[model samples]
Target: MLLGVVLTVLCLPFLWWYFFLQKFKSLSAIPGPRPLPLIGNALDVGDTPTALFNNCAKLLDQYGDIFKVFIANECKVFIANADFLEEIMTSNVHITKSNGYYLLKPFLNFGLLTSSGSKWKRRRKLITPTFHFKILDQFLDIFNASSDILVKKLFNEVGKESTDVCPYIHLFSLDVICETAMGVKISSQEGKNSEYVNSLIHYFDIFIVRFFSAWRRFDFLFKFAPEYPIQEKYLETLQKFSTSVIKKRRLEKSQEVVETTSDLGIKRRVALLDLLLESDDLTNDDIKEEINTFMFEGHDTTASGVTFALLALAENPEVQQKVYDEVLAVVGDETYVSMQHLQDTKYLEMVIKEVQRKYGAVPFVERQLEMDATIRGVHFPRGTTLNLYLYGVHHNEKYFPEPEKFDPDRFLPHRQSERHNYAFVPFSAGPRNCVGQKFAMLAMKVIIIKILKTFKIIQVPDHKPQLGMAAVLKSYNGVRIRLIRRDTD
Candidate 1:
């Protein structure tokens, strides 16, 4: 019986390879670090987020723009070239996300970020209008309110030796997303503690761990792994939180008679949840899926962007001064940042673009080809997984000369015109691109501008971001900086 089990296990890889041999050989022309039998290039990718990030960059340098890696039994082709990126990103047929996204199903289910085909199309159509200019304009109040709270909260840390700003940013972002998406604020910023936030961080840690684990990729094998139970625990916690919020919001909607008035007789501002609830086509479950999706994507991605932007500003005082001067010129002494103010800060916008180019929140995205296609004379069979390495693409020397330098001028009109349109896709591209990208950019500008207005961010001695790429790009070592009150400074 033991011999039989061992033999079956050994044969599994051979069986998998036997079926896909032709498809595998077709990709042999693509350059990559050589793969070993069965496990393939699994070990080459690294175990931790930091190692994985660094190793990926090294692989890109060696393999050039496009490369192949066999992570266990799965083959993933990493594409970083702008021209090739344009072909794949613009395709309507290759919109299906890779299998790795399945790990998020426990938390986000098949919501907008993970869903595909007709379901994704319908949901995208239904939710696209929620981010319209008029609707987003209504969110400025929420942004200003949240920024005020964040500013007040940071006042307590102004004189501290070095503050880790990531946590504070996370809380502030959670507060904003909760209000904008759900119509209720949990005051995560005020409370200064959140299990949901902690759970989210832990969830990403587990996901990254599993995402690179050869054994954990299989359900049957992962059942025995230690992360399984822990993942289930957090999944239950996350689900309960989302479920309770959706139920409460639905009850409130059910009890309301007037569309513009609340039970307290106050005028009600529409939230994403309110719009979703008004839809006749969706059930409470469908709404929960979307709510969870938005709550995670809307807040976390924005927080990561703002955190990195601050880090960039801290390290580059000249650039920071430029931004501060720009902000002063645009909206001097104004507590409320208007839509026009956000649009007019072209220099600050350029800085944000540079930050994204260097440290995009979602560093990489994955997709699966729906049908066979050829690019640059290389044939990709149907169902091949493609890793759109946005970080690699943004940092490629061909797109931006001296890519490591923090120069916002690269985004200058004439310079930007020199690069491929798909060269810097921080929010991704094509039909399946992020729908809330504009919303995210506006929110980030609001918080960052608000902070810079009050404080001069100084970098901690020798502090640098130890990069990591989980679901989002974050620094494992924390973003540490000192803040001096601008008035006192």
Candidate 2:
């Protein structure tokens, strides 16, 4: 009898919260898998990052644009359509980033990518001008130089009858990002045999591995998760690397030394490291966080995006030839592509946009709620999960027409993209959109230009590319393609 009373007391809050409270709410309109006892959608949200939320389209078709899933008793709302997305993203409602992003706090602190409210606002302002068009114009020199180094490396391998371009691109991007972000030129194109690239990659590998570990999922469980050790080491590496670079640069500048050879140019006019160091209101930790964010952001996504685009081009040689012919006609035997040439590469630009539509390197963007809010006629209680389902929205046939078809013509002239606000958000939308987007695009343009000018991107025989979810979706096997140097030198 006494035991029965105690048990009843213990169960009452959960029983009331799960049964009486949720029953009154009109969740019937939202479609999702049935919730489990106490756990809710815990089973539905996969443990591994590889297991994507299943058949979201089928569910959206059945339930509607706005649907609910309960993970570990937390109610999550997934938005699919433009209007719903606009409400959340636009000023229609003051919806903030979801608490789900708190998980990334261990890996990335309150970096611009994962901060909220006024802090995010202030940080965004300081950093916004850093990536302005004029600043990025300064970065084009590094972009062109790095692209040349990468093309030369690939040409050397293709010269030796190589049968893949993916690994080569990844290596190339890493080197460029290293040079751009840290202002340290490490030749990742030369393999891990080099000390600097090896140290950087060593830390980078662990950082990515830490992002998707099981500890991240059940973050509320452990006293201190395994990511703590991982992050400590990551920060250690970052600190050591940044400190050394800063010290070396100040020393070099003090001595008034000019450093470099013919290809690398005599000086670096501007770089990511310089931006962070120059930006006021950013403390040492803030600088470090920004540096870390830029380092990861600078390389992987751009590399993966380039790989996907190159693969798409390889699969459709007609399109590749079109791009090649456009380069020939427009640039007309220019040894190096200039910024003006990049602007004229309209077909190339269209192709990149189409690639982003078809295979965006990142498939989802997450945000937390500021307070209790309403979304799509539903009152979302504070701390509910809201996701802008990137893949679902991107592939929706209503927005992209024949969504699967690879046609750059879809983004041609006279077609105002204003018709669809949230239809195709490869880099997301609004003010919080990617700060490094311009930087990434410029890098890809230079690399693609130089590579295409020298070698034609070709497919390889054992072209089985499989992707596993890391910080972003990336090739586990690397993109396998052979770059056949044009004119066959």
Candidate 3:
């Protein structure tokens, strides 16, 4: 009886796969790497992070526009065409995030990034007002202050050998997010290591590892894995830190008595957290999740965007000069970058757009089908996951010719007007696009302008870093550039 029971258990998975999972077989018609019975293309897609990233690029090169890849019999259809992306992203039924985002749930909980259905709708509505032009304009003081610290920090590195600018840029972005989103100061620019910051880095590392390993996806297996203890420790630290900040802010909100006036004579001192605190429908957990969400999204993504912009500029001196000229022409010798200056820096804006096109911070956005839908004459049944490859789309030669060249003129108004609306989606398109995009753009513009006004970025010869995928797009080595003080010139 015992031998019979063990054999039955062993046969169950194969029986289920044959009787239930294989019946649909809609994806078999889609072209992709051949799959084995149970582990479909799992071995083909490498298990290590670097190999996985390379495998994705290789697959895109081999399979044009759209194709399928199975992760343990689960069909993930990768769509690289602009029209298909528009159809998928704009649909109301496909608004739910994919199962891959489940890895982020431990950190983000039911926050906007991971939430779905009515919960997402409600959270989005509640947080929308916090990014209004007026509210974001109020954060300019924080941006300006942080930019000053960043400039000073970079100034110390000037005339040295080419330095990896990623860490400094990361810290600057971190300080801006903490101050603007949480109304707290961590002084990350002071060059002291932050326990909270270190924990966040480790947390993301484990998240990447688990995301690539199918076995780690199961809670039972992950709980006993070697990395689980480290992940748990960092998660606890992050949660503890965020909870303490939220509680303190809540208490201060109850007794706060001060208000400051802006240059426009408007009384203001608001944060994203303050907006959440105003809503009666939200719980403490709700507020904490949102804070953590913004903290992660706002800082890391911007750092990638800005760091890549610098690298691109360093490689193209002529483009860098044009941006420097534009900044001087617009904001010349100003102590701080103003909203008016941000609006007027047209050439700089083009440069930023080009950077995002070449190196979008978040390489892909994913969605899962809640109902069967046909897109572009192709039918995708329910339970199918669509991986919208933003990086692939951005680099497609048909959309942007000579796609690898770093040319800012590609984003000129007339050129941009002629392209499809969805062709260049650095911030993505459709209803569920990034809410903090304007804030992110403004921060990037301010920081880039500050750096350009003070120094000329020069590239290290023949040393460009190869790209790698992580929670955000990153260089396997760091983004290194030499800063030559403009005062000397």
Candidate 4:
């Protein structure tokens, strides 16, 4: 009798689950990798970040643009079709981010990137104004100053064979975000690594590891695991750094009078942190989450974008010369790259756009369906997680002919008009797209124009990097470029 009772209790849950899954019989008709009886296709999923990324690519190739895969019996639909992506991105009901983003909760703690519902809506409203054109214009000075330091650092390696520009650009971006976002200067270009920065990198690495490992997804198991202690240590480091900066900035704000006018009768100075601090609806913890989010998003995304842009320029000398010529024509030996210069360098902008299409810093965006919806006549039930494969879409030959080739002309005004709006979404699309995209583009233009004007980037021979998936898209081996100094006329 005892044995029968135990079996009946266990069978009840399984029966319930089996019946629950049956209601989604419509989704079962969608083709995907064959699943095991209980664990489904979870074991077939890759164990490492790179493996997982590669597996997704392979599945897309085999299963076509839209297909399903079971992650421990939960059906996930991967969509690479541009139309489907547009439908998903534009839908108001599907605005909530996927559960996968919850992995960042321990780090970001309901920052704009991870929050949902009314909190996300309110936070988005509060933060959107911080990246206005006028505000970002003030940050140009910060961008130029940091670029000057980066150029000086690179000059030390001029004509001394190939140097890995990845670390240098990473530090340059770090400094830019610090000054512009946090209203503080870390001078990371000086080559002195901070504990905060080291911990930041370590935390991202740990997050990726934990994200891919099924065993670590369970809170109880991950908490007791050996990796948990290391993760906690880095988490503490990040929290400590962010909180300290917030408190320091708060103290400064408290001491200063609220100035409504500048020397030129313009509006007062605005920093990202200041905007957050001024909001009555937010607390110190809210400010910290946003600070950490901006620091991570603003710095790392641009770093990857700029690094890949440099790599592309190095591989294509003709393209590099064109950008250099455009810079010279636009700015004409001016030590400073102003907003006018940024606007006038149209060719350089196309090159950057092409680079983003080929190597977007963010490879994918995930969304969870809040209600049942039909995308291109296919039904997706509520609670289904959708992975919008931006990278795959960018590489799809149907959208971009000869996708492997680096061609900036693809983004010419005429050419862009011919393509689908959703085809090239490096910053994503629709309402929840990246808020600071303009700021990022302006910063990249300033730095790239500085570097290209100073030196001709040369690609190392036989050195195509194998990219790995982390929080951002990164190469297993760092991006190495040889710099040949340009003749001063």
Candidate 5:
């Protein structure tokens, strides 16, 4: 009996290896760079965000649209082809997010972005109503108010030869998300140097470092790293912040101070927190998880979008002038943008869409398949992670001509009609796509129009943005551009 126990214990590693090899055999038809043993192709992807971004581009260029790689024996099949992306992205069955999202569970828990199966479906249904058109329109007041603060802050950078727009945009986005979704205003823009704000930013930094480090990906191994304690400290602060907000909002609800009307007596909408609080089903813990999720998703993603849009516009004078013309024509010297104004800026919409294509804020999305699937006659076994490389698809020359060039007209009706629907997915696509896409778009438009109305974005001739991949795409060196104050009559 003692010998049998020892033998069983000894066989476990071999059994695991045998199954791992079988999975690889099943996916052998797919092409990828040769992976090293144990670590697999992890090193080929690089340890830094910039290197990772560049190396992934090289791999795509070398291997074409569909390829597979193994990270620590885990199979990840990357899909740059639109048809393959359409299949997995639109499917109802393969909606489980890839295992990489597990890293976010400590910070975000099982919120909409990280949750799967019935829980995700339920939470999605609950949260969808909060972003309804009526509510979104009301939220415009918050957006405009926050953007006004951002425009004021930019006054300090007006005469400078170059200003990094990323930090300013980050604070603006944080304020907007807090007011619109979390039902609280932490005044992050005013308190940019505060402990809370610094900790929040550092939390994201640590998360991305862990994401790229092969040795730190697993919790068992991460605990041994220096970042573990620092991450824990920041995560605790973030969680405490979320919990405190939830409790404060709950108290406000109990006191009946939560108003559904404005000072002018117009019918006002409640925040997402109000709606969630009204629901009998969600506990405080559940609400806290979602708050953290939206805070990061809504804040960082929009910051990236607006920052890149400014850089792109700065670099492309013709495009910037065209967008400015559209804004002037649609808005007609109005200090505030109404919903109709947002709708009528058709050309600006095109520019924003092009920005999404050329510089997608969230570079890629991942999903783990639950069932065996075949795409273009290539078999992908169950549990294979499908990386929908949005960056690669957006840059595919077959779809976008002169892919590196910034051209807003690529989204013109006739041109857009020429490509596949999945070809440009900055907010991702289908069932599990971002719930705040419309919110993000309106927020971005408000900020962009405000900035353009007040200042002309000028590119620094020699300076260029250094792009890096984190929770969102960011410029490690900052998005530098000169802002000249506009003379408005």
Candidate 6:
């Protein structure tokens, strides 16, 4: 017992030096927010994550571009400058999606959204082709059809009884994901009670709350002390929803496989899932993960972007009028839009881009250091967490003149052009950038064109929209707009 105590005492210093030394090492020379003992800035951050990020940007005004804050459990660096953001994003590893993203691991599993290294690489490769530009037309049709349902549903309840439309728009997006990705048309707008969609969205808040407040990071605890079948329930719900549709499609396609062998190689209707399901690399588990990733990524982001664009147009009448005219002149006498009509709505695209720039939906693309990387003369330690400060960068007057002003002309081909590649990144940056960017753009254009062509959008007197930040930017009170049907040209 005496000898064992002697050995244990000697080994303790080496362990302390290895772990504790790096905590105070190189970056101690650089200045950052003063961390309170034990708790650090966790107590100060309160419930406002967005405001906390904005204040972190403000810290750069005092502490320059690179400053650390002991947020949650670690000292995270906030990089506000476009140049530094560009350098880190463009040059960094494609796999730089954060280690702190373990917050999502319970909900996402080793799924593409939260997984790293070989799993991410393999899954991304298998699924990347699922979002090619050529496939966007199918998604455009889904968007326009869903927008019709949304508008029709809203039009019925239109007796100057304008209510917040965020949830409805999210329904449209969710429904679109069902049709476009999974080969199921869930009439979410027709009857707005979507328990599975609701459950899936519910997991986000639960995961985020636990991530910040709980002693265990959502995943770390799950490794030993598993969830009380809530995540499993959600997975089962999503799987059942997806698998039922997949089973039907496989049945339909099984007939096609037979017909192709028997009756002259005729094709059947194909979907994003069909493309993914037909792929060589993906396994059955991988296909399920890809579908789950699409369900989360498709609706949350597309809905937020569409919601913000409508809010922007509702706020600015001139922009709305310009969009209306462009739509009327270009789109033909069709009840709903086709893919070509979507491309022709130039002003509508500008409005979407401008709104995305001003109120970026998924504001910041976070990155973890894969290797030691120098961002603007400052070297970030390997394993350091970097928040992109996308909303901060968008609001910067340096890259965008009169940054607060909502100007669509910035996206025009000439005169006012792109200042930096990273300046207006609502879709995000790098190889890991949004795979469905073109489809997202097309989907938004179709919705905007359909709405602008039919209705003159006016903001309701009692309904002033405010930017509500969650996992994404959406109005807490849905955007309430009074829509008068345009009777004449």
Cα deviation of 73 in candidate 6 (Å)? 2.5
lDDT of 1 by residue, 1-489 (tens): 999999999998788766765666889888898777767787888877888899899999998988989876578898889888888888887889999898888788999999999999999999998889998999999999999999999999988999999999998999889888887777888874367767766887788888877678677888899989998887787788778877877777787743567658878778898889889999888998998899878887899999999999999999999999999999999999999999999999999999999999988999988888787688888878999999999999989889889999999999899889999999999998888899998999999999999999999998888998867898999999999999998
For residue 23, what is the lDDT in candidate 1? 69
* C-alpha TM-scores of all predictions: 0.94, 0.85, 0.94, 0.92, 0.94, 0.86
Ranking by lDDT: 1, 5, 3, 4, 6, 2
lDDT of 3 by residue, 1-489 (tens): 999999999999878667544644766667788866677778777776566667877888898778788777577887778999888778777898888788988899879888889889888888888899998898888898998899999988988888999999999999999888887778988955488888887788888888888889777899989999998889999999889878877776677631444335666478788888888998789899999999888998999999999999999999998998889899998888899999999998999999999988988888888888888887788888898888888888778998889988998889999887888998878878899999999999999998988899999887778787756888878999999999997
Report the C-alpha displacement of residue 243, candidate 1, in angstroms.
2.5
Candidate 4 TM-score over all chains jointly: 0.92
Q: Give residue 299's error in model 6 in angstroms.
A: 0.3
TM-score of model 2 relative to the true fold?
Answer: 0.85
Predictions: Cα RMSD each: 2.3, 3.9, 2.7, 3.1, 3.1, 4.6
Model 5 regions more than 4 Å off: 1-19, 260-269
**Winner of 2 and 3 under TM-score:** 3
Question: How far does residue 91 in candidate 1 sit from its true spot (Å)?
Answer: 0.9
Candidate 5 lDDT over 1-489, as tens digits, reads 999999999898677766786876877878898876556788888888887788888888898877888777578887888988888788888899888899998889899999999999999999988789998998899889889999999999988889998889999998999888876666788874367678888888888888887779889999999999999999888888889888987887887767754445665458888888988989999998888888879999999999999999999988899889888888878989899999998988999988988889988888887888876687778888888899889998878879899898899899899889989888888898889999999999999999998999999988877777756788888999999988832
Best by lDDT, which number? Answer: 1
- Give candidate 6's TM-score: 0.86
Per-residue lDDT tens digits of candidate 6, residues 374-405? 55666667767777777767777777778779
Runs in model 4 deviating more than 4 A are 1-24, 257-269
Of the pair 2 and 4, which is ahead by lDDT? 4
* lDDT (C-alpha) at residue 485 in model 2: 71
